[model samples]
Target: MVGVEVKGTTRLLGLIGDPIAQAKTPSVINPIFASRGADIACVPLQVPAADLQKIWAGLKATSNLIGFGITLPHKQMAIDLCDSLDPVAARVGAVNLVRRERDGSFRGYQFDGRGFVRGLQAKRITIKNRDVLMIGAGGAAVAMAFALIEAGAKSITVSNRTLEKAEALASVINGDFGRLVAKAGSPRPQTGQLIINATSLGLNETDALPLDPGLLHPGMTLAEVIAQPEITPLLSQAQARGIEIHSGIHMIKGQVDLIADHICELWS
Candidate 1:
């Protein structure tokens, strides 16, 4: 009786993604809301890349919907759709969470960066002065790379399938920090203290590993941005090879409190 009691007055939130069946945001963040005795519930909203614009309009017009979360393919696309962005979201050029204002406008925010750093820090996984090899150059990758540097990562090398995209992301991060901490390189992962798979490659059974498995060694810790399946092939392979691995679940856990406050406006 001391938990959330969803009723007519309960507000709703959603996690939107293309292949949403595996998302852990709802399960992870719901309990935090319940503990606060708030009448809020978050559900999954599966929308293909094509239908995102249409769904965004609908979610905005709906009542009792305070905000929603974004993941995967939509994080970058959702940026232009938002009326405004929080500082981090603007700086990272991605939006993972959006709050619907009373006047039918939406404000976007990015927690992926700080949440990621917190996730690793919570486990005593050292980030400071570490060299990071990040796969993919999409929205999430962009945020994490910046955060890694902020957390005192000595260097970050972005490696994407498309070499140009990786280079561009590195250029952006470096230009922002003005310290030349991030650079674009191949996915071969020649050198790094941490290896991050920030791509969608491991989301499917038939997907290939983001990097050369042979390149992975004991010196690097493999981390993921995918939450579902709990253990992706990348993590499994890395573990089998005597490498330390971190799952996307920690990223989910890392963002729970931030998500709660943003979506429910608990602090407001």
Candidate 2:
């Protein structure tokens, strides 16, 4: 890992979210910037939901602030603050990364889903024509659903504690694709070829597994979006069953280049 050296000319990039203590973006992103010999620094800023707008406005006023990242509750809220949204972000209605344009305007883009898909592809796991069962219908799930459809997934089933939210997410995807590409379903692992846990179920040690481990089979691929534990309980169980596993770290790693390229453009 390259050492981080801060100078007066170093560019500022931030990861903003409520309860940002657990964010790993800085750890993963700063190294990339250092390795590339770019004078860019990524830091985490804890901003409450009520303070987001004020904080965002203040950040934009800072001349040297090139870009930032949004996580959790902020992803959906950041959409309204952006001057423009990337096509994928507009369709997903969420933004994970924001770049300051040449005109000093902010452009929002969602990379969570794209990162997840790319991570799988990097590991030789194919999503095309595969049946996917995603547990959770929040911002991350929405992004992943659209990406899966875009990547040619045969079908996707969304399951969440609040069935209404799951239904709404499915509706959005179906509406966008003009086909029955997504649907709402229960938490029980179905016959899906790809099983994903996009919820915070595995964030805590005592949290229950998102799906029944007994239902996992050797031919299936299990994935999660929780990066903290690295090896989530769901993935651990899947591993014991000989099921292929994809951790949340891979998702973060996969998007590092995309995020770096976007932020670097400001300096270029």
Question: TM-score of model 1 relative to the true fold?
Answer: 0.95
Question: Which residue pairs collide, candidate 2?
Answer: none
lDDT tens digits, residue span 1-268, model 2: 2478878998889899876876778899888888888989998899999999999999999988898998877888898999999998998999999898899999999899989899888989879899999999888889988888889899999999999999999999999899898899987665548989988888778998788899987788999888878998789889998998998888888898899988887673
> Model 2 TM-score?
0.93
**Candidate 2, superposed: residue stretches over 4 Å from native:** none
Top of the candidates by TM-score: 1
Query: Please, what is the TM-score per model?
Result: 0.95, 0.93
